[model samples]
Target: MSRTLSVLFILVCYVIQGQSQQVDQDSIKNLRLNILPVVFYTPETGLGYGALGLSTFRLKGEELSTRPSSVQLGITFTSKKQFLMFMPYEFYLDEEKWRFKGELGYYKYFYNFYGVGMDSREEDKELYTADFPRFRLAAYREIFQDFSIGLGYEFDGYHVLEPEPDGLLDTSLDIIGKEGGTISNIGFLALYDTRDNIFHPTKGWYVEGAFYHSARWLGSNYSYQKIELDTRYYQQIKGNVILATNLFLGTRSNGTPFQDLNYLGTKRTRGFDNRRYLDKNEVSLATELRFPLYKRLKGAVFGATGTVIPSLDQTFKASYKGAVGGGLRYIVNKKEGTRLRVDYGISGDGGQFYFTINEAF
Candidate 1:
């Protein structure tokens, strides 16, 4: 896995280096492809390597489409033997009346567990290995202007490959479905979106809500229900400056597995480690200030506060954690506002650097 990722990284560098001299203005079209190499270092995963490719297109050409449909493929491998491969796609059909979006992935993750609640400490790190193949599909049809309703199906199979010795998995918490299980659920989705550009929205709002349930009849190892709400707003403060904000909330019923629970990290808590905190319920509120620097270059400052609790009944306590960071962006595809992002996120635990495509939101 490491060798393959290394080779992929090298190939992407070679291709990008040669792209500038071969640029052709007359060949410009609705189809755009962006590729980049990913490299990061973390204590848990050691040196990680990967590659990501994003393809965006529109049937009616970029001028007529409100937002270009996209497909993303990404993979990563670490010295710890952790592996991940994901392919996600979004499509618009029939003049934007119908929409399809989902993802399929395989993962062998060396996940760290620090118990199951907000009070869990960093010293409680327990390394566990889990292998899984997951997929979800959602299709929506527009019912009103800027509003859509849809249905989705999801399947996740989790197998515990290794459990930490004398660690939280067996000693501290008796988490549901710890031994491995399958979750099969059907969900309902509703979305309201008015973003001018999906890649880099200047002024608009996007809101989504979803409800899902898993039952014995659905081949689920356990029965549970989940609800998620995500809303984002963007405003052009001035020329070449935009303000973006996001609010996200998620909750699940009892008997939910740890994997299904919400965590503060990665996309939500940029400064913290991915999945650093876990619980049945979570809330995150964040904002980013984006502005241009030099030509084809941009910068953003972002900060977020979030927390996870075992139940929705918990008061919005002050135990909330926070992460703040700034990032640099280089416009990879100026026509579509596609960018390559490099960020350094810092929290009380420490800091982590990220490299990838597209905005954090």
Candidate 2:
């Protein structure tokens, strides 16, 4: 459940001092800051509170860059005793020709599991606690106008904090990496991005395809391979109205660990539990219609459908699950078109409220 609710109150004094002033592409600049206090409640994590601060600026004082680079830091604690601290950052250099992006986080939290496949029943739900530190780092070089190729490495170390005695994970003898181990993978990335701004886009397309391989030489506890393709399209339908769509497909092979396999939930299947359905392959599609409601306010209607399969060979044989919802958006940074979003999505199982910064895509 990646839900979050943020209430943003701009520091008016700073805005009046010219922080909101528009500067030409060739002018000197100061960094822009966006900060918000978060408060939200979910059944899984109980009441969570946190703050996120984002700083955006040009690199090497180059104001004509395609987009401003940004660094975001956040921390949160839930009433259920879950704690998380994270930093995500993106940097553009050499006149936006080179890019670096990644995230690092440490978490002590509880997660639920429903056995190992799409057919796993809700009645089989069980909970356990774990502590982990995860990190990913990537660098890309632009090879064309809006296309780039890159390489990235990721590390995830999981340590069981409260083992559930006789639970599925504790009883399953075939599940490798279950007792807590390190997973390290290095991969290649290819991307094509044409969005006017990374935070919000009225018209553009963003596509990425990548593959990663874990090997013994890389100090990984298990060896496996994974591949994914994600594409998103945005278009302005009329005055202040935009339509957005996304398609995502992913699969893993070569003795991939249970935790590393593709799963359906979270960002891809909003109404379901995070990773509620697990398997080696998954496919999902989502669409949303967004339009202005009033000054600084927006409304959206969205729907999504997805499914998980044990293997690529069984792709279409599985049943598809769906979710639909509506949301309200409050423009936080009109200059950059960033917004705070609140959505309520429902599936056959039930509904869940989601709050977050920017669009889900």
* Among all candidates shown, the one with the greatest lDDT: 1
Off by over 4 Å in 2: 1-29, 42-46
Candidate 2 residue pairs in backbone clash = none
Candidate 1: tens digits of C-alpha lDDT, residues 261-300: 8998767578777678899989889899999999988999
Q: What range of 10 consecutive residues in model 1 has the weakest lDDT sum?
A: 1-10
lDDT of each: 0.80, 0.78
Per-candidate total of colliding backbone pairs: 0, 0
Candidate 2 local lDDT, 1-361, one digit each (tens): 2222223211111111126433454642446667777776666677778876676667565654458777777788989889998888888877778989999999898777787777888877787788999898888899999999999898888765455799887887877667887889999999999987788788899999988998578788887889999999999999879998999999988578777877776665677777788888889999999999999889998999988887787767878889888888887776666667788887876666766667888
Positional deviation of residue 189's Cα in model 2 after best superposition, in angstroms: 0.7
C-alpha lDDT of candidate 1 relative to the true structure:
0.80
Q: Give all TM-scores, in the order shown.
A: 0.89, 0.89
> How many clashes show up in model 1?
0
* Local lDDT at 175 for model 1: 86
